[model samples]
Target: MQIFSFKKFLKEQFILLSLSAIVGILSALFIAFFLKLLEAATAYRNSHFQLLFLLPIAGWVIYLSYQYLGKNSSKGNNLIIKEAKGNQESVPAVMLPLVLFGTVITHLFGGSAGREGTAVQIGGTVAAKISEWCKLNQQLRSILLICGIGAGFSAVFGTPLTGFVFSLEVLVIGKMEYKAAPYSLIASLIANYFCLQLGIHHTKYFITSSIPMNGEWISIALKVGIASIGFGLAGYLFSYFIELFKKIYSKILPKAWMIPIFGGIIIIILGQWLVGKDYLGLGVDPNYPGAASIVGAFHAGGSFTWSWFWKLLFTTITLSAGFKGGEVTPLFFIGAALGNTLATLFNIPIDLLAGVGFIAVFAAATNTPLACTMMGIELFGAANLPFFAIGCFVAYYCSGHSGIYTSQNIGIAKNSFLQIRNNKLLSQHLSQKELFYHKKWTLVKNKYL
Candidate 1:
């Protein structure tokens, strides 16, 4: 009876998990469809519409989002991160629809946001609802919620393994919950299936050429190290800008809503007069031959143009103005471009720099070096793993304490210090200390005597 009962228990839990995973996948598919619609609409507006019309649309969406969802609504992503790390409560179901609509409207009106957040929120909210219905325990609920995140990312990005790792790694404050893996994997696979069925896919950057066997290893290594400086610097700068913008708006600008309004007008004027509209949206443009040529330029030893800088600024302001989506992919775009541009100075291989920039900035921004390293393998093929490992890890360390998500804990210092917080440093833990300090000084003559 005892043996049979154990098997029965496993069977029951597996079935429940399978059901929950299915819900996670379906939620992601639904979210992906909506995100695609928003993308298409944004594409049209950027190309065909006028900047004058965008100001009013941004105002109206901000007004609706404010009235219906409240200012607290935009906190969904932060709340999700907090909840995943043992907070028990999951994101509200209402958060799903609200963010979906708000982001869509934001992009439609050229608000300079992205779509990954919308999809992830939709999946997570759906999973949270399922957990509530089943009356699952806190651990189980967290697992379901993560499954939702993996599924959403997998469907939208077409990268199931990386999405699965991202789900776990994003929550890597410490001690991972081992039980979450099965659910996350199931959800990712299910979501990928649905994406395949619907013919839904998002932008994916890759290195198509093979790395030469027993060739240019030293050059590749040097390029990775050099480009990493740019990645680390850019990553830190991105976080800095967000905080500065927030302070400018909250402590410096006129008011909350008006700040975004002011920001929108500035974007409209600057986008048309100075930079043009290419930098105004999700940062994807398959239609532009420049996009392809630019991608190739990384392999050909080229630098980013002035337009890329404008796009980066526009994106920053868009998010600072209360629009939704994540800065992860945007970091990728900027890093790749910047890496290519800087590589020209070093005269190193362009493909190597592009690959390094792509992952290192992501590692720095999210503080997920391991995930981004694996991402390098998955996206660029395993051939680039050695250079990726060095560049990504170094940049991750060089990134300092700044990160886009304020809730992230300082588990360990970027580098070890002999004495932390005035106590003999047995091990490094997050503390309010400068990035570097002189090693502890002890005179051996008298020590404890």
Candidate 2:
């Protein structure tokens, strides 16, 4: 019996590893192509400048495309999360072209969004198709989906370990799936390697200032802790505003297609007249770098005090307006900008604060402190891992139970004081909380009146 079990284990390991490699390579290739196209689109938009005016038309085309061809593909990243959580529906294959096209158009027309959504969708769709082709069981299919997510994240960001850990951590808040670690690691490394081999390069950030370990260490820690609270609030506000804007849009424009048009017009008005073009699109362009970009946040006088707020507002509007893209990169920009602003006030090195904010905001919004800490080490260096941990974990708790991914399940409630049920989706949890508050307010009103 021992011999038979050993043989079966070897076979299963081999098959799973092989599938992981395939997913990694395919995801990397797709991400590479997507990045190249995205770069070209951004370059064209920068040079033309007039394309910004045609944003409404571009949005209309995107709306029409999805209306005609996208069958549940509009759910975007939520669909993948739902599938990983045992949803009966498979991730639709049409999601790849639809998201890719929609995101590209969004960027081309100066929609302030990020690329992580497109990359993740591509990876999930590919993995789902491969699982269908191989007729894998539900368990195996779910594992592959996790592998796909890691690969896509790794390939796009060039951070394999972060990707590996994020894949395991992101499915359920306050829980990590250690069972998928080896597969996710292998997939992330392979995808990052192949993405680089395909001529794709991720952005680099530096922290030149060394953290002091002397008596000043206490002061620094306190400042970081305080700043982390702000980071968490920024993350909470970002998620809150996006959902609020989405609700407002849906309420005002009952027609699904009209939402994008109205959103496009708002973006144009905001972009051209009020905010300038600094906060539009990805906010990181090699060809036309802005004072309010992620790179700019690293230096003194690089960003205005309110630069982070503008980016946050632009991104929330862009995403809530039915534009397609991920929220992660914009979160990075916002965090970094906020960090820059706070560093001057807190007497910390600007670059160091920016670095922490970059990862901490993402950590708060995603509720993945461990992954963001790893990302900090990967992007900025491990010299300040303690600061990274403090910022990330603090921000995570401060952000509360809210996050950008509403479909994400809460495996463990953040606090026992809250009467949240285990394994409840965040969306459901938020709705319940709102209902509870509403009921309390109604009782108060009746009593007073």
Candidate whose TM-score is highest: 2
- Candidate 2 collision pairs: none
- Worst 10-residue lDDT window for candidate 1 reads 422-431
True-structure RMSD, every candidate: 6.5, 1.7
What is the C-alpha local distance difference test score of each model?
Answer: 0.68, 0.90
The residue-by-residue lDDT of candidate 2 on 232-275, one tens digit each, is 99999999999999899989987988988898999999988987
Candidate 2 segments exceeding 4 Å error: 1-4, 286-290, 444-449
Candidate 1's displacement at residue 3, Å, is 14
TM-score of each: 0.85, 0.97
Q: Put down candidate 1 lDDT per residue, 1-449, tens digits, no spaces.
A: 44568886787588557755676567766866786777677767756657435664575566567567653556756667667665755466668767777777767676666666677777777777887887777777778878877787777667778777777766643224456787787887788777777777555566754556565767667767876877887887877777668667787666566777777787788766875655666665532334322344355523345433555677788787777666765676677777777667777556667777878887887777876888788777887788788878888777776677665555555656523332212113322332233122234334653
